[model samples]
Target: MWSGDELDLDAYLARIGYDIGRDGELAPDVRTLTALHRAHVAAIPFENLDVALGRQVPLDLKSLQGKLVDRRRGGYCYEQNSLLAAALERIGFQVAGRGARNRSRGATLPPVTHAVLAVTIDGEQWLADAGFGWQGVLEPVPLRAGARVEQSGWTFGIGVEDEGIHVLRSLRPEGWTDLYAFSPQTLYPGDFTVMNHYSSSHPQSRFLGQVVAQRPGADVRRALVRETLSSVRADGSAEERIVDTADLAVTLEAEFGIELDSEERARLERLHAAGV
Candidate 1:
């Protein structure tokens, strides 16, 4: 029920740089699923500029398509994963939404906020998350106990916790770090809309007064949180720098592959300068 029929499938395919001749044909299979997930994350970045700009982040298909596909803009998890779910559903794949709690911050458990997709191919199911910012998987991870996937040189694994909770983790130089944990209970688009309201508008929301953009590449992962832009390598070493207001627009365009129009750029520049 992701309204896949209404989605512009061809445009979505083109937006992700999916090539039928090279990436394989569109089908409800693991190969196509992997290609689409990988391409979507690599092409479309992860950012929350609208939230910082005090603009509404709409979840409708037309708004998603207009901002993400046509405008060539990036968005946070709700927008990112919703667009991916629509695209996957349009391609004859069975897709469902899952709400996940952010665990990377610390031992304190956060609320269920992140949106991911559960894609079933044949009798086997896969965790296809095209959002998740800098600490996300490049391709789908199999939905099972102790599932380990190696994308390029990076490593990711799944662990089953008590009460049927599933944890997604990344292997670091020291040990395995928990990225996020999700339950088996499926979430709907309406559920996401409710959560999106809090994330986009709430005063205490981390996205409200910050400039966050991320791109997790095979070789390096870069995240711009507020003024600092940090780039981490596969070995877990990171280098960070401050992004001044004067360099905000160029940094977003050149580093994150996000281009803003004149008005959008002006608003965002002012926000960045205010340190909000």
Candidate 2:
């Protein structure tokens, strides 16, 4: 029941790259969720391209849409999920911000590290995620247990964990694997920014350490840096590519719609060379 003023519709739509006047009505059923999910995946990519290049990424609504929807840039969890929350709310859907786990290398349980969305439509609550790096959910899944929901060649399930926490899982041929956990709590921008700062700045931060891998889907893409490695899948197989310093600027602009100046470019090159 979080209430903010009705968002500025036209500006928001333009920012997200949808022409508003033509499509006055948005489908409100499962189809609506599916369409939005597709548009999000196709339009907004899961990338730390900017951060890796030593750029500052803001999570405010104006900046989020301005980059993704307006300027045609992509972003990480906070940027993608925040703008999505705004879009859903503007179109009369109930949405809340929430946090999710960032799986650790040796831990049995996933660690909380990113932001996501909880949406309620037609009295049924669902988890809506647009920023999970490579393994993100591509469709809305019901907020109930023992039910398998399919999304972009992946299946999801919800189950109750200890302490009454809700766990989200991805189903593979082997079995079910935990993705993240959360209570039925609503988060605000400040909440996400705190986590964002930690992930972006900490020395142990994976993003800062090396190149990371992320693919929105099959035929989409993947990235590999000196310290990071990633594979993208469009048809469910991995597509891996290595980018060099020579390709960095063009890749950011062409792949993520980010514009960098000469000084920013020099700084990014230095950071890439330093690998810190």
Candidate 3:
């Protein structure tokens, strides 16, 4: 169980660009949660830079704050959601950590590799996730069947499948797409540590040799995968281009706000050259 007693609330708020003082009172309500969610996704991008650099992504609150908040770096699902969970709990919100299996189209349902939050406020349960990279939910939604939530013109909903699994779906021009499926079972800190180790270091893990950076905005989401830069608009339109090796560093810093050091830059260049 992760406790929020030692979380640096002030530093976390500043990192996410959220001003709780402006609201006069720190309330654990839907409005505040929505604002915080939006701010988090906007300010802190979703990236696998550490994994690309062959470093283990830490889950402790202090280490997360140091890397994501103080150093201005982003992280993958485990790291990103863990940081948000700590901040939310410190603000008096009821939070529980949950794990999920990737159920998106064409994805093999592997062991639970995703972490999300189940939050309760005023007798209602909500699903909040700040780490899902590109096609993730932008705002917390009611944890009910057929509950629809609109975010930046994108529509998302929750559905209960057989055996009580909650499936998150997104609306597209074609039809609804399954994002992932999860149960309400609470996951302990040790569970996440084991999964994080596999995710960050396994030979076949997606994060190991790939470079992924994503930043969601009000109108569009920018994502970089290897040499491809894609801008996915909220209206179901997308534009993609292949970035040259010479422009990779500048594109990463400018488009995704990731300023890599010389060593990291060289490492990424080498990965691209090897076509891994």
Say which candidate scores most in TM-score.
1
Candidate 2 stretches with Cα past 4 Å from truth are 1-8, 11-24, 27-29, 53-56, 104-111, 209-213, 218-229, 232-239, 251-261
- TM-score per candidate, in order? 0.98, 0.80, 0.95
lDDT of 3 by residue, 135-167 (tens): 887789899999998888989999998878999
Compared to the true structure, candidate 3 yields what TM-score? Answer: 0.95
Off by over 4 Å in 1: none
RMSD of each: 0.9, 3.4, 1.4
Which ranking of candidates, highest lDDT first? 1, 3, 2
For residue 88, model 2's alpha carbon misses the true position, in angstroms, by 0.9
Supply candidate 1's per-residue lDDT for 145: 93
Query: Native-vs-model 1 lDDT?
Result: 0.91
lDDT (C-alpha) at residue 74 in model 3: 86
Which has the higher TM-score value, candidate number 1 or candidate number 2? 1
lDDT for position 252 in model 3:
84
lDDT of 2 by residue, 1-276 (tens): 222243465665555455535544564565676567656765666667566665577777766656676666667788777777777776678788887765423255545677888888789888888888656677777777665777656667888767656777776565777777887777887898888887777766667744343445634445545534456543445544556777766765665555667886677766666765
| Candidate 1 structure quality by residue, lDDT tens digits, 200-266 | 9988788988899999888999999999999998888999999998999899999999988899888
lDDT of 3: 0.85
In candidate 1 the C-alpha lDDT for residue 178 amounts to 95
